[model samples]
Target chain A: MDLRDPALYAPAGHGDAAVLLALRDPATGALAFPRTPYGIGASGTPAEAAEPVELSGRATLLVCVTVHQPLSPGMQVPLVVARLRLEEGLVIDGVLEGTEEPPPGSAMQAVLVMQGERRACRFRLVGGAA
Target chain B: MSGLASMRPVRVVGIGMHPYQFPSETPYVHLGLTALRGALADAGLAWPDITFAAIGTGAIGMAAGRVMLRHLGSTGLEVVQVENASASGSSAFRTACLMVASGQHEIALALGVDKFGSAQRAANKDGVPRLTPEAEIPAVKFAMMARAWRDRFGLTREDLARVAVKNHGNAARNPYAQFRKPRTLEQVLAANPVAGDLTSLQCTPRGDGAAAAIVASEEAIRRHGLDRRRAVRVLSSVSSSEHQVADEGWSLVEMVQRSGLAALEAAGLGMAEIDIIELHDAFTIEEIVYAEALGLCPLGEGAAQLRAGQWDIGGGRCAVNPSGGLLGMGHPIGPTGIGQVTEIVRQLRGEAEGRHHPGARTALAHMIGLGSVAVGHVLQRD
Candidate 1:
């Protein structure tokens, strides 16, 4: 319940990092991001000590209809923010990678995206848009 | 006398609003005072006549209600603060109505005043878990919904743009509107896109404003010899929160549908009886989506009905957002909901001049917030 406590999320070691990275749901077989509610107390245990399940990298991407990205103090541009639907039916918001903006409902595959100090799941188009 | 006859009838005897504008250096006290004074003046009553007040604010924390009271001489009237995201104002109005209906107070005041400056972060304090980055910001979440709507209903970009055009046109006639200039579909389409097909004009601007309404019991109306002809009766008021469903699309629309149904049932009326509506059209697409959800049109037919001018002023059975919705009128969060009540009251009284829907006898004022809560009110000419 103490969400702010740093000890609640601290990983044990490199082996634990893999465990955290491969976190998945046992009930529905969906991949879960570490620190999320399901990933933390999944087994009725503390997040740092919870057992992690392996998950495949595949996912279905729901293409974004529109995007808003503020580049600087006064400038903003259209960006791609897609919804990734994992095989377990868990969907998440993630950034889409490509040179061109894909049409809405285009298929996408899950990938890792780096955001300075953080890394989260992102998606890339499965095939080029028609 | 309809389904509302059973309960002690509460009437909106007065309504007032502070012109919405961009966040300024002006203090909250001044803004609150302006609206409170305006409402008191409109009601033709003094502050002492108000037995209770419910103040609605989303972001102004720490004694938000008392701060406004302190400016008005602190008459020892009971004051309660309400926070329900964008629905804060309507929720506050409902509280005041309940006070009068319960016989706890003869005269009650509901005031919504809010300011969102550059430093403010748009956070929902109601503790709805932010599952993803898109869900954190309102635009992205609504954008996704808009995209899904487009995909499901085959709504074109122009169909969405028309909503902005119509609302802006309605706003132009409203002197109290924040954005009075009418917009064209081409101009709306050319505007900077926010999420999906939503352009800047399609989204409500976060501004600062205050709106106030006075609800009086029938006894108080008779005691003050108030003009009953102009008083708008509160037929029904209902509020509902969103269910934690996995599908975001149904979260908002479904909430509105359920709450609106309850309101209509309480009023002993159906959607067909509604002549005017002031809804929380936070986005252009929301107007279409909510129209369907509220039974203005059959499901998935909001866009087509809109194109047919069913929602336009004087064009169909019901005129939607004749005061220009949040899309065109400017949404100052807490004040927005109370402002809807003001518009509905005015419409029911036939005071909405240029934008008045002919023979407007019944009206609905609705608002929904980020907590995924929806509030609906049915109002009728008294």
Candidate 2:
């Protein structure tokens, strides 16, 4: 897949327009620019047919990503996040929504939490305030 | 700690908070005064009627109590400012409660105001003192401490994941909470580690907020015609710090253990007698460490009890942070202490909806601050 193929990396769904948003349970350490382990390539990298996005995959995670809005205390999206999981639940630092930027200089991260196997719900972060 | 008023019992006549968020063009004094007004309104009393004011804030960032209260109009009463790190406001509130409960004053007000939490604070160029070194803010220093604890206990990252999961679940139910949503272990463990294993999520977010509680005496309660259902009295209050810089006996466990003993004894109660508990879970691991220190469970035995659903809202013995805590809930220094008390008050009255603690009559509000300071308050309906 080409790196700049617009179709593969279109902003997936809810919270796609903003650069930062609130992360609820999946805690991102920083309050500002809170990251996520649930987003996929939104605008840069094209998803391949043979390789599925997983959270437990043991390797560098470099992909284009986008969201509907910045993560915030009361925000959630629809099937917008694409999580890449590697083995052993070994979550690489660079793999989180690590800031919604493009790939190739994305500073690779190891991730063990991939999107679940349920459509829409399969790859979405469902959330509400406690 | 005894009086005729104490025998008759008392209740929270007022409650207040500076909205939990970054300050708008709104001045800190404005926020503080707003909460003062809110507390007075809640207590159904007039400002002229408030006999005493015990206010708290931090540093000299605007005279904390004095400047903030000036905005509330003129009051020719003695005003004392309390600056106890994060626990500043609650300590002051505790003072007011004790005064009213002891029949010292009929109508008293407790104010907690922090305008600098969300906004940056003025740096002390003369090299101001800090709980930790200049290079280590709270998250970094505590993360280092947590790593040390893990190494000592032989605990894995997976073991700590449960803390985030449990707290987030409880936070999801608190409306006044800064963060009120549930989280997953995977998500928590995966978040950015501010320092070592402490992820950004595990650290409390800084926000701006205030909480105020109006304390009234039984005579004042009768004078003001306040209701009983909303009445909750101070049971026990303890204020102490980590045994200062002791090489041989320095332990957070002992500091908390001694403080808990004093507070419980003052209230004539025990850990098992508490129906609801509100702890300072600023960091995910702090919950576990303090649970043991407070004698809720044996040291290192917290994880087992926590995993057993023993501390659920309706469980016989419940430890909670219905305001999302500092984890899922936001942390705005001064008001946080009063905020904790506010939650316990709600719990005692069975007023919580989304995260109700059924039939809760007694509750504990406890917090630990930098400099190893701790304050525990016991409140009961009887």
Candidate 3:
């Protein structure tokens, strides 16, 4: 299956779960998401000194909101966007699985789903964890 | 790192604007020149009197200063273009103030002008791929902020809509505002929903316009015989960018708080001494959140203040965004910040006409740009 953004995540070779690609600063133990080539900004560690790591794709939903209109190009209406705190202590924004806004502090995990012709990463509430 | 106060005093002797309006076929040169001419006329000075010009623009390409100023006849004045996203105008004004205060130039001009739809963001060109590009949209991002505020502070949708109501009403009386019609709470709430609880009326309208401010040293003011009573003294200028915070979502708020406090401290005044504030209100929630961040009220008390009419013009405490702010006055990127200064100067001079806030002797102008930067200035009468 083709992933929407191959640099961000990859299949975990099980169910629908995926592992998030990230970079960790060796000195300060800081984490940066999406694995940019420019290296970690917090510690000023060069890209070569930064170590690649995979996040558990598990997070606690910090906040969520539903976009009622197609504000961006090629955006679908009623999209759910949320800020989540990863278990590794990094915060990131992602698309939620449902149209409804989940209450803050809900448990969520990354899952790969079909978006048009390509598979994309979306966050779903952990079962019985709301 | 001495503040403006530590240097020679700089005062704003003239301010002018070409009313913000919807995108039109009118050339940007016309918009910019109109503002320059107006400022010169208001200052009772000729174009040659301006020894330095700082052009603030977001979309207009290279050498914008020379291209626009050449029509006024070249006098070999120093020209530089400043671009700091929405705070471009504020940055330009700060540059002009510094030049005058440093004695590098006796007279300086800060002019901001821009049109809609042509500006671009550097984040897109950084080559970083995102998992959710839609989250980058400002309205969506701010919607998430509104939701977070609602969850943490129990902010109601009506509480957010009331900001639009007040600013829109203020705009109704402002001749230069893009949104000149007053909107009721119902009208605001019923407006087209753009994101989450944020309606279209709660967002700043995209348009084109221009604003200019002229700053001069006391020596120049006296030599030129400028009216000292009309001059508004610039007490302090402060600029800063976002810092890493525990809550990444509130980084912008942290920047505003730090910059605002620094500005007031540099000016040797407290929040109580500030009778007027013109801040970046591109969205309704910003006015509430930023005001609280700037120490206008404690956290979770902004809505209550708005409810009590404390933030209203002439309603007491301090009038926030008396020029209608970006929500009603329109955000033309570069021009918005200088326009804020123009409004504050007008109010301080008792010349805001229909929208004047009585006894507005001291004012603060705060602006935030795309780089997550904040710029603040404190101005006072006499």
Candidate 4:
């Protein structure tokens, strides 16, 4: 299956899980996710000094909300959106796999799921982890 | 950087507004010109008397200033358009203050005007792709914030509704507000849910309006014979953007705190001295969180303050959003921030007849834009 945004994540080489692509500034030890050519903004490190890295897709759910209205074009209603803290300490927002809001501090893992025609990254609660 | 206090003093001599309302067929020119004319009349200054004009707009395209100002008879004054997202008006007002304080201009105009739907976001042009585009919607982002606050601070949904209740009640008395009807907690809760716990009534309505503020130097006020008794002095102006912090969710709040403190420090005042506050309340949750962030109360105590009516117009401690705030007054993009200043000036001058905060002497106007940037200003009467 084709990925919706190949630049943001890729298959983890194990069953349906995915790994988030990120960048690490060599000098400052700072990490940025969804790797961009702009490099780490905080450290002002040039792209040349940044190394490619992959987040394990494991994160702690910080907060989540259910969007009841399709506020944006092509958006479906009652979808769950969440802010997650990656294992590597980077915070990012992503779509949750279920409409139900998982409590903050719940352990979650990223997985690719069909969004219309393309596969997109969605976070799901890790079994027996909190 | 030297604050406004260290420089030559600047005062707001006049303020006017074209009442904010739902999106209509009214031309942006009409909305803008009405405000400009009202301000010129209020300040007792002609078009040529003004040395500079800062046009704050979000939707209207380039050269908005020249096109709009020429209709009032071009005076060949310096004109620059400022666009800083939601804080466009605040930035324009700041520019006008700076110009007068730096001796660049004797008198300047900060005008904010906008229409709905035409504004565009630069985030779409950036190459960054998002995992959840829906989260980019402000309502969704703030709803998540409301959820986080609720979990961390035990904030309830009713607490959020109360913000709407008070602001809508305030708006009912503000002739310039977009939402004029007062809503009860039940009405707000029963309103259409937009995202998370945010109902339609809890969010700022999409609208079109114009607001204008004329700033002048002390020399200009004397030379023009403007009423000094009504002029409110610009005490301080501070602007800053978000910095990376441990909690990404509260990054905006962090910026507000830094800028708010810097503004107070620049003015040589404390929180106890602030009599009124006009803040960005595009969402109900913003007022509560930002008030706490600005030290109106300790963290997790904003709800209690609201319940106690301490933030009301006559609640005793301080009047917040006396002109109805964004939730009720209307956030017409560029005009929202300048409108806040206009409301502050009126309150300080004892001119906000119907919605006046009694004995209001000092006021602060705080606004945040799309870049997650924050701008704050402190103003005082006499």
Candidate 5:
């Protein structure tokens, strides 16, 4: 994943579904979305993980990247995206399902960013005194 | 063969639903069988009379349709499973109705059931594409859409509040619904926001439940001496999903008008003929967005309709959700679509004592699920 792409711009209250056509370079642990197809709104959530996943055509990817608030919990619950690869594939991406948030504590603000109508927007994930 | 879209005058003989709560004692199969038993009893039919069965559910791994039926003594008849996002149950019912109406089957049963499994477990590697999130959680993304609607339509807090108030009143009378308690508009505005402007009541709660319905053709109904009064005719059934457009060039209201037009056409009726509607109200804002989409009201005019008590049960031109809907009732995934169908059946039959639509002869059940998909089924009492 590009560490500096507009997708990483996390703000609270902003989110949706987008089909990201990504090619993962195994050697570098890098992911890139050359094309994206987003729906009117998100039908489901998406996530990526520490595991290496090869992308096929335009794999569905979720990139909440959590907005940490002083009261909000941190990035403990990993997001998940499925049906990623178009053809040949390996190693699942994103966090496992049913992964709950970690214990509360001091929290930094977390902003979630996703592709929007014209461009990208940001919002903070409020609530939680972690 | 003309598919389900061509069939007509589909009648529901039996209907059943499991409560919207976790089943502590029943296995998934047992839950389904029990619902089947209830439906058979409701329809006054025997298991052997059922010529076909369709099951809608998301959690069951494979042959979900056949396994659940076998437990209930379902003969090795045609059994199909429907997996249309959250509308799985309703899709199954529609399939059965098509079969019976097309003369492919004499009697058919559609049962929808689901257990509370992982929210988003890995999906089947079907050829069909699944909606992958690009950069937001489901709640956040939906909230964004709500925000966009507010931004575009200039909806006010009262506009959203009307939906909560309307659904809560509907929910108050639903016995099997997850949340029967009522809420006022003031309480809704004061509730906490899950994302953007989405308060707690705006989103559907997750629960566990199952529901089933039996549909038969006019010939079969007459031959079997079924209760004609309780028979609910299937006017039309239509399903569509996101065509993968950037923003769906047309507005939500227009899309629903497209779907509503097809449904009304298939039923040989008009929107004005629809007495009560169980359209998708997964979120409070969705009611605002989708009511317009379904052509229940004009563009940017849903709040005014609610303000005028148009969507209320006893109000004029009732487009309703007395089962609390996904909002107050708790959406148990698969069962929701069937739950909506169940509500329509009850309303048409005048069996819903506390939450009846008051002499509704024609009713509609509309549901939208994952994939930006939508399904509409029209029903009328004999």
Candidate 6:
């Protein structure tokens, strides 16, 4: 899916569908997480004009830093941020999921999760199971 | 030889700065004039002696260079303004250096002025549109890089915290530094966290300030009968934009590597010959990353070098950020690059009282702007 297309963004009150689409691979019947998106071709843009690609295989995640921002009013902690290179060619940034405090460069799987009121892509430690 | 080396020698005859502080009702004129006058006085020259001027600022638009410089009596000399993100002031200094080195002008002034707190936030509608779903802010990008550095090099939180400790300590001695309080490793660790492992003390606080430098050709110095003993020669200056990196948020690493090497080559010196350094430590993690990129150590070995006390003042090794750095020195965007140059000039001139690096003969100043760009300058006392 072209990221710039309005369709890539979930319709109002359709957060669930957005989460599902973010995690499901259209090229295959199985589940997969969308990797970093970017534009290609003559009009290559960043996230919006980029091609749609999912993690073709397991990817390693490196959690960079976590800081609390005003999601509502007060501050929140453990807002884990990370970078992952997909089996394809895209390297993207996302939130890291889970509370176990995975070591840096830990193997992780991208998953759809809720960040405040919005659906966001995050990574979860694979526990050598991916 | 680099273009700068092939041209006539340019020397920094004077440097000045307004103490960095939180934005207040004060105008940019006061900030700019204060630094400019200080620079003129430091150089023992008058405003009429300036043949050209270059002003660097990130925000505060509308002919900013002319507006502030007019207060100093515009001799109708060329006044150019530059904005290169965090490297704004460094870029300005480079421009002034080139003008002098190329013999385009005999005497030039590079001034940087900024006041963000009193300014209005302009929408980012003009630049490249955000293409990623995630907001790739500096904190986010650096946080991720910190993680990658850790995974690749075994750098830990404690190792990073030491940078804040050292820089804050240096800032405590700098009257011009916005943050004058020294921090301990425990204090740094105890502060509120920002990005991955970065804390409030580890991140730079954007404040309001200005810095200025007067550069002159050898002919100008001779004609004006200026004190040659104190003039710091600009051996090399190099500016570069982000290159394709191994991954996103790693532009700083790549850009610094490219520009730093070019700068050293231009200066005709090795990294070991540099006595002191001032770099864009916008975050503590950057100090580690840049140290490695600047060839002070191998990739992933900065943490070890930090622990070995190699970068400390009077530690018999090159001092990093003796002027406190962006972290503790106060990063007022435009003034940051000039501020780094100010510190280097002072150190090389033996004017950095209380925080002097003993026997310092050569210094390097580095700054980076995210999205991203890097600027490097090598200066020598001889």
- Tens digits of per-residue lDDT, candidate 4, B1-382, equal 4569889999999888999999999999999999988888878888889989999999999999999999988778999999999999999999999999999999999999999989989999888777777878899999999998999999999999999999999999999999899999999999999999999999999999999999999999999899999899999999989988874557888999999998899999988999999999999999999999888899999999999999999886799999899999999998989999999998998889788899899988999999899999999999
Provide the TM-score of chain B versus the true chain B for each model in turn.
0.94, 0.88, 0.99, 0.99, 0.91, 0.96
Q: Which candidate order results from sorting by lDDT in descending order?
A: 3, 4, 6, 1, 5, 2
* Per-residue lDDT over B150-209 for candidate 3, one digit per residue giving the tens place of the 0 to 100 score: 998999999999999999999899998999999999999999999889999999999999
Task: Indicate the worst ten consecutive residues by lDDT in candidate 6 chain B.
Answer: B126-135
User: What is the Cα-based lDDT of residue B304 in candidate 3?
Assistant: 91
DockQ of each two-chain model: 0.27, 0.01, 0.80, 0.79, 0.05, 0.29
TM-score of each: 0.87, 0.68, 0.99, 0.98, 0.74, 0.86
User: What are the per-residue Cα lDDT tens digits for candidate 1 across A1-130?
Assistant: 1122221122323321211134444454444443443443224444344446533434565546446655234322455666656554556665565435677556665544444454444456666652
**Which ranges of candidate 4 are over 4 A from the true structure?**
B247-249
lDDT per residue, candidate 5, B150-183, as tens digits? 6567777678867887787778788878778788
Candidates 3 and 6 compared by lDDT, better number:
3
Off by over 4 Å in 3: B247-249
Q: List the residue pairs that clash in candidate 4.
A: none
Q: What are the runs in model 6 whose C-alpha is more than 4 Å off?
A: A1-59, A69-77, A97-120, A123-130, B1-3, B118-123, B126-135, B247-249
Ranking by DockQ: 3, 4, 6, 1, 5, 2
For B1-382, candidate 1 gives per-residue lDDT tens digits of 1234466999999999888877787777777778889888888888899989999988788678887787778789999999888899999999999899878999999999888853244554433243244544667766777777877789888998999999999989987788889998899999987777888888888788899999999899999988899888999888888764463246677888888888898898999999988888888888988888999888889899889988999999899999899988889887898999888888888787898888889988888887588888899995
Decoy 3 TM-score against native: 0.99
- Give residue B185's lDDT in candidate 5 (0 to 100): 82
Superposition-based RMSD of candidate 3 using all C-alpha atoms, in angstroms: 0.9
Candidate 3, number of clashes: 0
Cα-based lDDT at residue A109, candidate 6: 60
Cα-based lDDT at residue A72, candidate 1: 30
Chain A TM-score for each of the predictions: 0.51, 0.21, 0.95, 0.95, 0.20, 0.49
